[model samples]
Target: MTTILLLASLATLGYAAWYLILCSVSPWERCRRCHGARSHRTAIGTRRDCPRCDGTGIRVRIGRRLLDYIRTEYRAGSQ
Candidate 1:
């Protein structure tokens, strides 16, 4: 039981560190809805901008958004 718990904790910590690094290095990820295409094809063969990413084909990482929120809150509190 203890061994399993230790392994689980180590894995969690490793993933958190990896995600933190990823957030800092590349804070944007391809949009899931458009698969980075920036536009979607309709049934009539017309293309339209991806609604999810607003045609940018990229979205802010959840971790980055969380970090931004935390920073904002800290700044507000400090001031």
Candidate 2:
């Protein structure tokens, strides 16, 4: 049981690292709700830019931001 748990934890960590790396390299993805339309229908029957994306139809790559932050911190630490 302990061995299994250890393997599971390691797997989770590996997956997290892979996902962060992918996010660091991947482009911004479209907002799911707007499907890249950059707008959505409001309750008043008017269209408005998606609040999540501000009508740009894209969001910042969280992984990339995280990677940049880590890099900055490491540089500061090294200096």
| Candidate maximizing TM-score | 1
Q: Write the per-residue lDDT of candidate 2 for residues 32-75, one digit (tens) a residue.
A: 87988999999999999999998999887777777789999999
TM-score of 1: 0.91
Determine which window of 10 residues in candidate 2 has minimal summed lDDT.
Answer: 21-30
lDDT, each prediction: 0.97, 0.88
Candidate 2: the clashing residue pairs are none
Candidate number of the best lDDT: 1
Query: Which lDDT tens digits does candidate 1 get at residues 24-49?
Result: 89999999999999999988999999
- Error of model 1, residue 74, in angstroms: 0.3
